[model samples]
Target: MTTSSMKRSQPFRSLVNRLLDHGILPTRKLILLLAGGSVAAALGALAGLGYALFWLYNAFLLLASILDWRSMPRRGQVNVARILPEQTDIGRELTVSLVLENHSGQPVPYRLRDDLPFSFERPPDVAGVLSAKREIVTYVTKGSERGLYTFSHLYLRCQGRLGLWEKQAKLAYEQHIKVYPDLSTVRGYLQSLQESLIVDGKKFLLKTRSGTEFHAIREYVPDDDPRYINWSASARGRRLMTNEYRPEQGKVLTILLDCGRMMGVELDGRTKLDLSMEAALTLAAVALRQGDQVALLAYSHEIKTYVPPGRGLGHLHTLIEAVYDLQSDFVESNPLLALEYLHRQQKRRSLMVLFSDMENYLLEDQLGAYLWRLRRSHLLLLLSLADPLLHDWSRTAASNSRIAYVKALAQRFQLDRKAFQQKMTGAGIQVLDIPADQLTLTVVNSYLEIKSREAL
Candidate 1:
C-alpha cells in the first residue's frame, strides 16, 4: 500500500488494537471456557483425576478468541448519488432519490441512516433498511416559502458477529434543490385559451359598434353595420360589412391578497393563505397573457408584498418571487387601511381581485367602510375559500346531542358565509366562494370570462 493509504488506515488499526488489549474481544469466550473447565475439574475430583481439565480449558479459550476476532467485519467504503426534481411547487409532494454504492470487495452488510434536511420527513417505509449499497426514495411536500434546500450526510452502521459491537461511519455528500412558485397548471390553461381563440371562428368578432374601440371587420351579414354599409356598393348589389371593436388593450388588473388570522387556518392539508397565493399566481399569469397590465398586493395589518402594474413575462417572474415567502399575520386584516393604500397606489380605473375570507362578523365590524370606498373606482371581485370539511361533517352527523351541536355550528358558519356573499353582492362586488381544490381553476375561468366580456 502507498504511504498515504497506510496513514489513512492507521486510526482504525489503532482502535482495533485498543479493543483487543482491553480483552473486549474475548471476554465472553473466556467466561464460557472457565465455567466448562471448573465443571470438568469437579467431576474429575470425584473420579480422583483433575490435571487434564485445566489444559483443555486453556485450549478452548484460545480457539474461541481467535475465531471471534477473525469473524468481525471491516468497515467498507461508500459512495452516494442524490437525485432531486429541478423545481418544486408549494403544497405538492417532491420525490428525492438516493443511490448508494459500496466500494469494498467484501460484501459489507451495513445499515444506512440518511440525514435529511429538517424541513423534510422520511416516508415511513424508508425508516428501516441497511446495506453496503442501497437506494432510498423519500418525499417532501413543499411549504409556502420557496428557496434552496441542501441535503448533506449519510450515516452508516457496521455490525460485528453476535451483534455485540458496531462501527459507525458518516459519509458526506452535497446536493441542492430549488423550489419555485407553482405555475404549470396556469400555463396549461393559458395555452388552451390561446388555441380556442385561434381556431373558433364563430366566437370571432364580426362588426364594430359606435362608442366601442374598433378591433376588426369581417364579411358583412344581413344585419351588418349600416354606417359601414358602403351605400354605393349596395346600389351595385355588393355585400357590405362593419368593423368590430374589442375593448382597448392596457386595462389594469389588480390582485389583492389578505394574509391575516383567518387566512392562517389550515384546511385539508394546507392553509387558506397557501391556496390563495397559488390562485393569485395563476390569475396574474392569465391576466398578463391577455394583454392586461397586472399588479399585486399582499396585506394583513400592513402591506407585505406589492408589485406595481406591469406587463410581460419578466413582470410575472418578479411578482411570483416577491410573494413566495409571504405569510399571514396573526392579527385581523385592516381592510380600511388596505383600501386606502390601494387608492393611493392605483391612479387609474382597474379590475381589482380580492382574495380573503369575508366572515360576516369581521366585515361588519371592520371592513364595511372600506368596502364602500373601494367600490367607487375599481370593479371588485372577491374570492373566498368554502370549507368542504365542515360541509361533509354536517352531512354525516349522527342523531345525537353531540352531533346536533356540530350541525348547529356548521349551519351558523354557512349562514355567515352567505351573509358575507350577500353583502359583497349588495355593494356590486363579484364574488367567488370556491373550495381549495377548485380555486386555481375558478380564478382562471373568471379571468377568461372577463376577457370575453372585453372588461380587461
Candidate 2:
C-alpha cells in the first residue's frame, strides 16, 4: 500500500484499552496457576521429589501463560474516523463508513458498532483484523420516513495479546444528513422544459393566436379566437384554417396532496404518497416557470400544511420544502375541511390539481356537494394513482374459479372508478386516472393544453 494509506490503517484500541474492553482472563489464569504451584509446594514437604517436580511444572505453566499474554496486543489507541454522504433519498438505504487506522505498529483485531439514531435499521456487527494499515468498515440504514438524522459515536472492541483480555473505546464522530423526497423527478422535467423553452427554443413555446389580435396562421379548431379566418387558405387546403392563440400565463395553480392512510399503499417500490409528491413537485415546477402563482396544501383529517400562492422559479424550493418531509396519516382525509381551510386562506380562483386515491372518495353523493363547491371557486383536475395490480388481474388468464373471481373483482373496481369520473365530469370537473409513472407527462401536457385552449 502507499505510505499515506498505510498511515491511515491503525488499530482502533490500545492493549491497555483492550484489557478494559474485555476481561483480563489471561492474567487471572496465570494467578490461578501460581496458586496451583503453592499447593504443589505444600505437597512437596509431605511427599518427596515427585511433589517438588509438580510445583516446578506449575511454575513453568504460569510462566508460559505470562509470556503468551505479553505476546498479545497491549498499548495503543484505535485511530478511527467516520465518513458520510452529503444527502440521501427518503425511504432509501444509505451506507455509513468508518476508517480504522492501526497505529500500534502491528495488526489489530476489532469488533465495531456505531451508536445509530432512531428510525435506522441497526447495521450488522463489524469484525475484522486491521492489518498494520488503514481499513474501512461500513453499515447500511434505511430511513423509514424523512427528515434529518445524525450519527454521533462508535464503540470498538479488540482482544489483547492473550486470548483472555480485550479493550474497547468510544470514538466520537459527528455527522448530519437529510432524507429528502425524490427531487430528481422534478429536476429532470425542468431540464427538458428549459432546453425547449427558455434557452434557445422560444419558437417551440410561443403559439399563434387565432383572434382579432392576428397571431400566426395555423390549422383551426372550434374556438372563440377565430374572428378572421382566411377564406383563400380554406379554399386552397379545402379545410378549416385559423390562427393559434398565444400561450396563456399569470394564472393560479394549487395542488391538494392527500396524506391519508390509503396513500401509504406501496407501488413500484414507493408509497402512494411518494408518487403523489413526485407528481406535485413536477407540476409546481412547470406552473412556476409559466409565471403562474402556485400553492400547495397537504391534508389528512385536517390541514397539514398550506403554502400561499407564489410565482417565479424560486418558489419551487418553497413548495419542495413544504412537502419534503410529509408522510401518510393513518386516517381518511377530510376534503371538505381542507376546502374550508383553503378558502379561508385564499379566495382567488385557481387551477386546483389534487393527487389522491379514488377509493378514498367512493361516497360520491356525500362528497359531491363539497367537490361542487370547490369546482365553483376553482377549476379542478382530480388525479389518482392507478392500481396496476388490478390491470394485471384484468388481463390474466382465469383458469380456475378463484382466478375468475379475482378478475371479476378487479373489473368491478375499474367500473366504479369510471362511474366516479363520469359523475365528476358531468359536473364540469376534470379527472385524470393514470399510473404513477405516467403522471408527470400526463399532468404537464394537460396543463399546457388547458393554457393553449384558454380553458382556465
Candidate 3:
C-alpha cells in the first residue's frame, strides 16, 4: 500500500477531538471572535465593560464545539464493509465498492478514501449520504502492474450535523488483490469467434470441411459445401440448410509456455511473457470452444505448472488458473524438459504450440534440438515475438560510424533469425514469428487455419 496507516485504530472521540488539541481546524470564525473579545477585554478593563463578554463568548464557542462533536454517531451505530474484486486484469480500471450502513437512523454524510497500492491509480474522494439506513459508494482505479496488490487502510470520516466536527476513523480492512496479465484482448477475440459461429449458425465444436462425425444442423451459408445439405430439414425450414458436423471429440491441444530470461525482456513497455500469456489464453479459449482438449505446461529450467487436457468452455478457466501467476525466470529455459514431460504424459498426437523469444535463438547452439525431438510425435508450432525495435534499426539509414555499426549488427541478427525460421520450417515445424503487438490476432488465425485444414 502507498500510504502508511496508523499503528492502531483510535476511538471516534479521540479522532474527532483531535482538532481541539494541537491542530488548527477550529481556528475559524469562533476563534477570531474569541481573539477580538480578548483584545476588547484588555482595552476595556479600565472601563469595566468587556471582561464578562470575553468569558461568555469563549465559553459559548467551546460549548458549541463540544455539542457538535458529541452529536457524532457512536461506535457500533455505524458499520462499513468494503467490496474488493476477486482479481483484476493488469492495467484495467475496475470498481471497488463500499457498503456504509447507518444504524443511527439519521442521515449521515461520509468521506471515504481507500489506501491503494503505489502503482494503482488512487480513486477520487468518495463522499455520499446514507439517506435511509445504508448506502453504497463505488470508485474506479487501474492496476498498473501485475502481482499481488493490497488495500490496507480506509480513512473514513462521518460528519456531525453541524459540520463543525467530523468523527474520523481508520478502518483496517486489508485486501489482497491479485493482478494478472490483461486477458481482455484474448476474451474479446474469443467472443468474436463465438459470435461469428452463431451468425453462420454453426454449433459449438464445429467441424471444418469434410468430416464423418455427427454434428448439428444449421442454416446453409453461401460458402458451405452442398453435399452435406439436409434435404428434409431444408424443406421443413423452407430454406437451404446444411448438416453441420462436429469433429470427433478429443483433438488434443498442448501449450508450452517458456518463462525464461529472454521472455522477461520488455517489448513495447510490457514483458514478452505478458503478451504471450494473452496469446496462450486466446488459443486455449478458442480451441476449447471448438471441442478440443486443451492442456498447458509452464516451464523455465524445469516444469513449474502443468494443466491436464480438458475440453469445453469451462476448461479455459483451468488453463488460465494454471498459468496466470507464472513469472518469467531469468534462468535459461529447458524446453527439452517440457518435451520429455509431455512425452511421458501425453501418448497421443497433439497440436503443440511453444511460446518463446527467437531474437537470439540462432546464437544458442542447442535450441532447435529439443523442439525437433518433440516434432517427431507432436505437430509442433513455434511462436515467438518479433521486436519492432529490430525492424526500425534494420531499416534506419545510419548517419555515422557508430549507428552504421549498430545497424550492421541489427541486420545480422535479423538474417540469422530468418535462417533459423527457414531451418525450423524445413524440419516440418510451423514457425509463427510475428510482431509482439499483433500476437492475439495472428495466433487465433493460425489455429483456425490448422483446424480448417483438418490437421489436428
Candidate 4:
C-alpha cells in the first residue's frame, strides 16, 4: 500500500517542482527564512543557548512553511470591459469607459493599467478605484486619421495583504472604434449657407447643363430659353417668360494625402500628415452632404489606400476604412509618380486637393517641374499645415540665447514657407497655409468658396 501511495504522489511532486522552477512558488522567501534560522542557531550555540535557538529555528520554519502554503493559490481573477464610442471626430475629446470586475469569492485588490493605442493615452495622474466592479472613465482627443482602431488589452497587478509580491496578468477584451474626420465646422458652415440662401429669396434653381440633379425653376430674364417658355403659363399670363433652373447636384472633389517623410513633422500633438488627413476628410464629408461625389487617396512612397469617388452614406464608411492605418514613410514623396498614379486611376477630370508641405528650395529645383505637369491635367488646390509653435516663437521677444536661436530658426522657416507659397501661386496653383486647429475649417471654407464660384 505504501509503494502504491508513493507512485501516485510522484506526479504531484513533479508538478510542484515545475511550478517552483517558474518562480511561481515562494521559494526565495522560504529560503531566506531558513537561512536566518540557521544563522540564529549557530550564534546561539556559540553563546551556549542551545534550547532557545532550537525553539527559534522550529518556529521560523513553521512560519515560513505556513506563509508559502497560503500563497500557493491565486487570489482572484479580474475581467475588464471597455465601452468605446462608435464614431468620433478629430480634435474632439472622446470618452471611453472601462469596467473592472473581480471574479474570486474573496475580496481582491488590484491595480490596473489600461493599454490605449499609440495615438491615445490617459492624461497624467489618473487612477482607478478598487471595488468588486468599478467603472473608470478616461478621455483622449481623436487623431486626424480616419479609420477603425482596436483596443484590447488591460494590464493588471494584484497583491495580497502581505504586499511583498504581486500577481500580474493581462485582461483582454476586443473593441472596435471608428474615428471620423473633423466635420463640425464644415457641416455648420454648409447648414448656415443653405439657410442664408433660403432666407435671401434667391430661388433655388438647377441648371440642366451643369449639375446632375434638377432644382426648382424661376422666371427667366435675358437670354431666356425659348423652348422652356411654358405655353400654358403664357396663356394665363400677359407675356411669356422662359423658365430658368440651376444645377442641384455638386461637383466631385478628391483629396490626395501625402504620407511621406516631409509630412511627418510634429505639430501640436500630432503629425502634419495627420492634420492634412483630417482636413481632407472634413472636406469629403461636406462635399458628400452637398450632393457631391468624394474620394480619398493616401500615398507615400507608394499608394497606401484609395477610395473611388462615390456618393451617399456608404461612401463615408468606405473612405474611413481605407485611410485609417496610413503611416508616414521616411522616403521622399515622388509627386510625379503620385500624380501619374492618380491620373491613371482617375480618368475623369476632378478638383484635386493635395495636402503636402512644399519645401521651397527642394521644389524650386525638382518639384517645380512636376507641379507644372500635375496642374495641366487636374484642377489642383494645395493646402499645408503651418506649425503654430514656430509662429509663436517668431512673434515672441527673445529673452535668452536659446530663445534667440529658436526665433532665428523660426524666422528662416517662415521665410521659406512664404517664398514657397508665392512660387506655387505664381505657377497658377491655389494654396492655403492653415494652422493645425483651423485646418479643417479653412479647407472646408475653401471648398465652399470654390463651389460658389463654380470653379470645378
The best candidate in terms of TM-score: 3
Which lDDT values do the candidates have, in the order given?
A: 0.68, 0.76, 0.78, 0.67
Give the better candidate number (2 or 4) by TM-score.
2
RMSD of every prediction: 9.6, 11.2, 6.3, 9.4
Off by over 4 Å in 3: 1-61, 105-107, 129-131, 147-152, 162-164, 174-180, 189-207, 211-248
lDDT tens readout by residue for model 3, 1-456: 323344344465576656432222432445566677767667668677657756776677678778867777776677778899889898888889988889987777777788888979986789877666877889999887777778887877776666665666767788888887788765664667443432123233333644557778989999788999999999999998898765566699999898989899988688999899987887787888777899999999889999999988888877776777789997988777777899999999999888988853564577688778777788988888997887899999999999999899999888888888899999988887799767766776777767766677
TM-score of each: 0.65, 0.69, 0.78, 0.64
- Candidate 1 lDDT over 1-456, as tens digits, reads 999999999999988765532223323435665678878777777877666766666676667556644544544454556676666775567776666565544344445555666656554423333344554545444534555667677665544344333445656677776566566665565566443432122232212243356556555677755666545545555656455555456789999888889998988757888788877887787677656899998888898878899997678888877877677889988666667898999989898888988562345465666766777887788788887867887687578989888888888878778877788788887777898877776776676666667654
lDDT of 4 by residue, 1-456 (tens): 699999999999987755432233233445576668778878899999986986878785777466644543253455667778777776578877766665554454555565666666455423443455554555444544556777777766654444334455556677777766555643454465442322122223222433334454456566765777766666677567455443345467888888888888887567887777766766776678677898787887788777888997568768766875577889877656667788888877778998887552245366666767777767888887776777899988989999999999999888888877788789987877777777666676677666655667
- Tens digit of per-residue lDDT, candidate 2, span 1-456: 898765665454355455554434433545676667767776876676666667577767867666655655553556778888867777678887889887667676677888777877787888888886788888788776666778888777765554444455666787877777877666665677342433222223333351123346667677634666777788899987865445556689889999999899999778999888887887888788767899999999989999999989899988877888788998888777777787788788888888888887775356777888777788888889899999999888999999999999999999999988898899999888898877777777777767777777
Model 4: lDDT to the true structure: 0.67
The top-ranked prediction according to lDDT is 3
- Segments in model 2 whose C-alpha atoms lie over 4 Å from true places: 1-76, 79-81, 91-111, 116-145, 159-165, 172-174, 193-248, 395-405
On the 0 to 100 scale, the lDDT of residue 144 in model 4 is 46
Clashes of each: 4, 27, 0, 6
The superposed Cα distance between candidate 1 and the true structure at residue 195, in angstroms, equals 4.1
Error of 2 at 232 (Å): 26
